[model samples]
Target chain A: MTRTVPTSPPMRRSTVADQIRELILSRGLRPGDALPTESVLCETLGVSRSSVREAVRTLATLDIVEVRHGHGTFVGQMSLDPMVQALVFRGVLSPGDNLRALREVVEVRMALDLAVAEKVVAAAAGETHPELRALVDEMLTHADHGETFLDADRHFHTMLLESIDNQLAGQLVGAFWDIHTAVLPRLGLALPEDLRQTSKAHGDMLAAAEGGDVAAYREAVIKHYEPLQRALDHAN
Target chain B: MTRTVPTSPPMRRSTVADQIRELILSRGLRPGDALPTESVLCETLGVSRSSVREAVRTLATLDIVEVRHGHGTFVGQMSLDPMVQALVFRGVLSPGDNLRALREVVEVRMALDLAVAEKVVAAAAGETHPELRALVDEMLTHADHGETFLDADRHFHTMLLESIDNQLAGQLVGAFWDIHTAVLPRLGLALPEDLRQTSKAHGDMLAAAEGGDVAAYREAVIKHYEPLQRALDHAN
Candidate 1:
């Protein structure tokens, strides 16, 4: 059975998708809102079920709606991964060249990084997750490896994000990593002094994590990002 | 060929995708770096070609890898639109009121919006694009219908992005619109008063477009968003 098929003409699926998305977005439709059943949709939109189905499928990919087996379709609250993936991909096309845009990106990254750090501290205070400690070991292993260390470094941050347990925030931050890579090499190797400071600061961050000191944890993260930004500026 | 695949060990596609992505990200492989052919990748990772293809496809979607029609895949440069889409989708999935996250989203939106406006000032200077003017007309249609002017509002900004001819930036900004729908009712009525103010501001923006006065254009956009932000706060 179809839901409210939009009364639009050919290419009805796109039209239906657009209208339904428009309503859900404008009216703030939530889960369980009965989308016009197939018949109602057909009557309303004056379209075929196939068109409705296609529209519904597109929405499904966006996680805008869920099609149940036998039961009626429901609204979907999907993960941000797909959308995040698209943004990062597009950002890749431009390569972040505008000095103003780059600066803005960095500034925003700082806020997100700080927020993640704050969360990490809160999580640490509540419990000692061995997984977090294990990252330190991995970091050490990467420190020994020449080229492979970057992955280790990324892993440390990715792990830190996981500890925060905000997947949406994590995904947003992940996009930064991609853009960062596009421009990072121009920034040059971390100054030994900067790396030293980073390591020491990381130690402090670990402590904050252990102690569950939200403020300190957040500060530590900001501290880490600051040098990276400086290094990036130097490269650019 | 799959590089990160572990055939005998049954390595997961995600594992391979992650490793390859990191490699590209770390500048181990630069943009235009010819990614290893599939067979080589399979041999290196001891995995099947199918696994390699899957991994590459994921990276392609992320814009981390691009496969030519006949040529092999190469590392993708930064792309913003897809990443933003993915991020926004993830944000929608996150639990909580999302009001705070919306603030961050708005922050990014403001940056992108202003950037596009600024770019339009550059690109549309003395250039004639009836389409943008047409968007203004479309806004009127929406206003006449007593329908929400959000789509037209979005189209206007999108027109600006397109004016600057930045597809990725446009996509990032579009994703923001999609996510911001959650806060719409609280955002503002887009009532006659708001629409008039918006339409007037848009007219001024067109003047800025003709004059290439970026600062003036940005100010005009600020005028539009400020009330919307306040409405959001009031609604929440």
Candidate 2:
């Protein structure tokens, strides 16, 4: 004997997801808080078990909801992981000779970093950032070995944004950085040949920040990304 | 008689999603390119049919894949819709006395706008944006009636970003604006009472752009967001 199942349309799944989101909000559920079980949600939403399961699966991708096997569902951390994934996929999907997606990511990253230069300088006023200095030193060491310091470079940018006191900005910096790093390799694009120039740019940024020269810091930020921009242009 | 079904673990679902993404990348599928059918995907990935369905649902949420009813799944538009949804949900989940999520959105928007201000001014040099002026006029007309011009305000910012020639920045401006507009009403936050002041800030922005004065334009952008900032602070 064969059993037949009803197919839930995509629109219905989306509506069910929205309803679950509304349920979470109405109940004032925080991240990590347990949500109603699958059967419970099915009954509450007046939808099929398959619909609830599909909706939960969808929300989980956005980090809006978390599902733990055997344990049940809960609120999610709501991180920007989904954005990074989508961005990286976009970069990967761009046809050869069409690096617009990656270029757009770089432009936004530069814009945000340049825009926050003054704020970062102000936040670092009369304060020493040993952590940032350490990252720069690590980059320089890697440069001396004629190798790229991807980890140090990522950490340096993340640490720089920390001074701005904007969590969203910090997360964006991280997200864009992840996209750039993930996409560049897949495109067969090499890092700038002049690792020293890149390393020195980080040093210049630190010096300008410590000296509280916003103009110099902004210039350094531009100088830092210039090499990567050239590589992208060359690829295009 | 009762039928038994096996439950797929969350990790398995995630792995299947990754494999599907890999398949798309390997096949060089562009947005709207249809994927193999569910049975084909299950056979190819060697995963259970239910696992493939759940994985597709997850990928659909991130917009990495699109599933059309009665049609095959295809590569998605890969737009920033998922980001906007995640951000709006974040803002909505913030309880009273905590407007941090919304404030962070505003700060990022302001930073991005300010960062691109000089570019916008340069791009507008020797050129007039009739569309932008029309938006400002629409905003002013709304102000005269003691009402808010949300659509005009949104379009104005969007048109301003277009001058910078950065697609990602434009999308982000739109995304954050959506979040702000969607979240503020839910929080029971009211727009600033001085509609005239808010409307005039747009005028100043336009005037500054037309004159190619970056400083003035930056100031106008800051002024435009100040009232909203004040509202958020008051809410906090």
Candidate 3:
């Protein structure tokens, strides 16, 4: 099949950044892979050293590249920090009575939990996550003491996320979790009188994991977040 | 109920950044809200001016604040540029034969698309999006001419996302889409032989939207992505 080729445009000063990004990607550079020195980049791209430095700095600010002191520039680790911060900022800035934003957050979290649950169950091969079981136990113990088990509750979900063994999944889940925690205070959410129900929901999930039932696990995960969903509905 | 409050520790330099963040949140600062001058912040927090500047600079780097050349610093708009860049970088850097990471990306995209479809269908109230109809028409026309309709394909999904009207949702879908596109070339994905199938799937989605049948809409979406999923499976 013949396709038309578009005419090429002249490279302007601003094209330097695009060129550099293409260079890095085309070279298949990974995190910690060093880029050519500024002088070399300048000579190769036929751009000034200052322009190359500026472009590199801009990339660094976006977490695309890292400049180590006393060392050369290298590809940077993928980070969810900025995304997490953006979510928190947007959540807080959402207009009054705009519960849709909150709902979207909850919806995304539930989806992620559902996906991660299936992964955790699959990874277990009909076994259960021992760390998740321990966390659930800690949650029950704290609830029995009439104390909030937020930390243990967080750990339970985090443990399941870890079993997925995907950095992207972990980062996205963690970022959304931060948004949920940040908004919880403003929602004035109180612990349900029957914290035991919360425990029971988690127990169901653990059982489903043990049975390798993905559908049941998803249902249990949804049940676990029902209280928060209810609170959000009431707020709306 | 009695709870013990921990005593405050002596002021640490590193705490200055946290204190500034707290100040911003406590004040309910929004994007474009100007922050206090460096001198004022230093005095209010009982920290040195340099420390105040350093904190502000760090925030600026994270795109949390914008320092105008002439005017003082202000809160920055919520941005997903960094997150998009991070996703693209991570997708490229993923180790060889890492089908799990690709699966996670596909899972998240499917979940998001499902949620957005429900929202779009509900919002339509039995009416279909005319813009989507136009895009689909363009897609079929292009497909008939032996051209790839990737742009129209993207617009159709993006239009659905816009109808949801949640910035967080749009940002995430765009980020995950970036990862999907970045990995597509590596997968050596080719167009499916049955262009008519692709056109029919979209037509079904449009029909579901008109009928306000969310389940049907979601099914159509899954059908739309089937080609890519098959390609990934083959690669694995």
Candidate 4:
């Protein structure tokens, strides 16, 4: 009898993995949902155990699946911290384009800043955190000293996130500033006027936040980023 | 004699490394430009070699500093792919409210989809590639076939990217999709109209591209994701 033949698929491991992922997506597998055992996957996918394991490993890296010490692999949900770090790591690899790159970073920053301010107002209805208030005062006090102004300014913007109490967001935004400040001089792009203009945005944000005027708060935040955008555009 | 014990100045490795990075960003240090070496950094920063090396390593991980095995570390250019992957990873990560996370990801997708459409039209404006046309037809035929559709669908969406002929953009977008399709379910969302709406977006995108209307192409792409935003809202 002629031996039976099968597809002899290439990249069997990847195929098995995609199949598994598809199942998870469609079936709404929870984090702990037990996948069919390794042996079962091998038999079903017509692949070896090693191939199945490799697929599982890749998913694990993405944190979409987890392999426990004693238990079998299950769906995973990792918060985005590790993933975010990975992105900045890769961002730095690009060739000399700090000027443009910084500008791009600022683009997202402006949008995020506006969103942050709006959320704070919505959540708090114009109440200000004392710390945020103090930081605002500090911004005004040090306004004439550019370096001092910038430091206090960085803290104040960060405080807005702190006021909202979204730790994940605070960290993400903070990370961006950490990077921006770190790369600023290398890009050799700065506009004192931009910083001065930014102070007004802060003032506007604070006023709107205090008044609990959601519309004004949103508009203020968006306007705040205008100078940053202009500065970035000039850098570009 | 009890020497006056002095508080050690905070390790300035990060500061030094940052300065070097600034140089890279500012265009003072072009990609592939050799760094002054451990000895040089030490002299410039008034720090120890170990500190310098640490800073270099930090930069290396940032992908800002590339250490050639023998030649030494040099200033590096930036690549958008790595940077974008980093952002998407971070964005998904440390995600706050489930709704916001989903909304943010979908919003980003909308932006990128516009970019992809524009690129596709720009690249494929004058003529069509038979391969691309075939892929679209295959996708149209396989629509609603689930597994089959998904496979062809990947190709079809990917074709828009290929139309741009920009490998880095394709890679970055591909990475986002990797994250997208992975958590497709836990995301507790899909287009309100589901695949039908997704298909409509694809069809409209292709139509705009084929007709060579850049603005219309972008508009169609932007509207295509409306279902995605609705899905997120509905889930919330």
Give the clash total for candidate 3.
0
- Tell me which of candidates 2 and 3 scores higher on TM-score: 2
* Tens-digit lDDT track of model 3 for B70-130: 8998987766655665565566556364566666687788767776776777766566577
lDDT of 1 by residue, A185-225 (tens): 33333432355445556666777888978788777877866
DockQ of 3: 0.26
- Top candidate on lDDT is 2
Where does candidate 3 stray beyond 4 Å? A1-28, A32-62, A65-74, A95-100, A115-117, A165-167, A186-194, A233-236, B1-75, B98-103, B165-167, B182-196, B234-236
lDDT of each residue in A89-155, candidate 4, tens digit only: 3344342554555554554455456546656776656355676667676666566465335565677
For candidate 2, the per-residue lDDT at A115 reads 75
Model 3 chain A poorest ten-residue lDDT run = A3-12
**Decoy 4 TM-score against native:** 0.53
Scoring only the A-chain of each prediction against the true A-chain gives TM-scores of: 0.59, 0.87, 0.75, 0.55
Q: Please identify model 1 stretches exceeding 4 Å from their true place.
A: A1-178, A181-183, A186-236, B1-15, B18-45, B53-57, B60-98, B115-119, B126-128, B149-152, B163-170, B182-196, B230-234
Candidate 2 residue-wise lDDT, A151-170, digit = tens: 78887887777778677888
Two-chain DockQ for each candidate model: 0.10, 0.30, 0.26, 0.08
Model 4 global lDDT (CA atoms, 0 to 1): 0.57
Candidate 2 Cα misplacement greater than 4 A, ranges:
A1-13, A43-46, B1-13, B43-48
Counting only residues 3 or more apart in sequence or on different chains, how many pairs clash (N, Cα, C under 3 Å) in candidate 1? Answer: 55
- lDDT per residue for candidate 4 within B34-98, as digits (tens), equals 88877877887788887677666545543466788789888754333223333333333323456
Ranking by TM-score: 2, 3, 4, 1
